[model samples]
Target: MANPKELDPAESPQAFYGAELRRLRLAKGLSQEALGALVFCSGAYIGQMESATRQPQKDLSERLDVALGTDGHFTRLYPMVTRSRFADYFTAVRELQEMARTIYEYDPVLVPGLLQTAEYARAVFRAFDPLRLAVETDELVSMRMERAHILHSPTRPRYWVVLDEAVIRRVTGNARVMHGQLAHLAQLVRSNRIVLQVLPFSAGGHPLMQGSLTLMTFVDAPPVAYGEGPYRGQLIDDPAYVENCRWAYDLVRSAALSHEASLALIEAAAEDYASEQD
Candidate 1:
């Protein structure tokens, strides 16, 4: 039999959300039987909702609201069919990000999370104020690595990242760690699953000097531009706004190093760091 964990190439988001809800409910110690007792639905009915084989309607949310006794928190079943599960702020962007056929990110300060090496991540995190304890920092690094796992999935998104020269020279980790990361990036380029464009220090003036953004496009939905600062972010779904970001990124890509040149430059940078370590 086929693996239950695999994507159908055309699976609906509703199915994915259902699977998550069921998992979350069970994890929270709610028995299907007990949950059913409160919601006026049989165990089988709850099972159906959990599998995402069943659509969650507004009426069902209203009914579950009264039955679950948690106001609308747990009972407010998300309509994954036409809306994002994320808050109005982030929306279902993460879900969509996972589902995208292609993703493009602009990193003006540091490497985008998807391309970061684990050790490199730790150094970056340490740069944040009020350093976390070692164990806590390790867990945070693990979480970021896990998030990068989506890129390794069979139906993973194709990543195209434009990195600022500042990021390549940020000196996040020890020289050894930085060398390893640059070498790893060159390896990713060889795999051809990723495209890297390096914006040199020479490109002194550009439109994106404002900040960074990650743009994603899915097979079944409109493109989105996610813009963020040090602590704030916004999902731009408006056609005009998204389109504008696209063109701006194009200019940046054009001004950066070409593919072959970028790979050579990365290798050179790695060796330079390796010399520092030695």
Candidate 2:
């Protein structure tokens, strides 16, 4: 058998947690596959956690406690690991986005990060971390922009977005920035690169009113759903849960304007922002 790669726990909390997990699993003489089976995730997921490429979810942590007989060692460390990672829940989502054949999203507030311009993204990062210094904000903004590269790839997922009217009307930075952001969205829509829909406020009290949700479908693997809030995120892969979220997303889509109408609404909002900038 090959020797395991060295793990430097001093790198980060995730590294410490992951190295400890690997040590415990190895001491128990369990293969990654066997361990993942006990924890109800994939061997690949276990590998990612052990390599510190992915932060273990709370559910996974509890299962690991029971499986490895760690008596809550992993569970107790879950929150600490999350605090040390940026976009904690999104790490897996980003991986899935690359492999997904279709990506569907519904956002009730700000624009989706996949479509955000640099200026808009910076403004969002600043708003999200009001106490963060410029260097920290720049790092996050760069990461967000880097993730957008999936859309620019030659073979990309078919992206469909249902944005609440508020997303278009709300200003992220200055009026000029908002105008540029909306204009960018409009160009993407016109180019057939993405499908855009606006869920009008007049529709009122529709499904997915509570928070934003992303449903991703792959050619081979099972579908997944990701729900996001201001400060927390959850990745749901259970078939039943993902199905219910998919159903709710369909309802939101039904309540949204048709593609052409939605494009017109977006463009109109951009013009409104441009006039204000004047």
Candidate 3:
């Protein structure tokens, strides 16, 4: 068997937690499998935690404390490791995005974060909280741009997105910003970086009209779904619920324009924005 990969404790809070967990487990003379058995999870899960590839949950941390006789070490460190630049509710979803092998998204009102240009992201953030300071807005934009880096990774997930017509029709920031944003989307589509479908206004009504949904599938774990609204988000891992989200996504896809048609529509929208800019 191959030796386990080495972890750098200095990488991040999660890495430190993972390294510490490994140290403690070894000190207790327990293999990952043995420790996982005691915690009621799979050895692969323990290995993932040790490698900082998986985020540790509160309940799992508590269980690790009990199994490793660490007296709440993991439980106490959990919050620090989970702290994120994203919203509290979105922390887990961000972590899962890094591990997903495929990602499917449906947006009804705006461009998805992963596909947003810096100016577009700033505009959205400013609109969401007009009272926010410029520095704070900059920080949020930086974090968002950092998240977009995953798409450029060699092992980036296969991304498929369905966008409602309003996403492109609604003017964000100004005509210039909208033109740039739409142009960026067109470039991405033309380069085959992502599969995009537009759900036109003529589609009438759809099952996912209420909110946005993201479904992610992993290589070694079960699929999960994320639903988001104005200021709230929920991460769902229950097989039944995830399956239902998948079904809704399929229905939405059926109601959306074909990839080629969608690209043409996006290009036309961009041209309209450009005309307005002139």
Best by lDDT: 3
Q: Of 1 and 3, which scores higher on lDDT? A: 3
RMSD of each: 10.0, 5.1, 5.6
Model 1 misplaced stretches (Cα beyond 4 Å): 1-93
Descending-TM-score candidate ranking: 3, 2, 1
Alpha-carbon lDDT, every model: 0.72, 0.85, 0.86
Q: Which candidate do you rate higher for TM-score, 1 or 2?
A: 2
Cα displacement (Å) at residue 184, model 2: 0.9
Could you tell me every candidate's TM-score relative to the true structure?
0.68, 0.73, 0.76
Which candidate wins on TM-score? 3
1 or 3, greater by TM-score: 3
Pairs clashing in candidate 2?
A: none
Expressed as tens digits, the lDDT of each residue in 91-197 for candidate 3 is 65777788789999999999999999999999999999999999999999999999987888899999999999999999999989999999999998887789999
- Kindly report which residue pairs in candidate 1 clash with one another: 86-91
Regions of model 2 farther than 4 Å from truth: 1-87
How far does residue 141 in candidate 2 sit from its true spot (Å)?
Answer: 1.1
Q: For candidate 1, what is the TM-score?
A: 0.68
Worst 10 residues of 2 by lDDT: 1-10
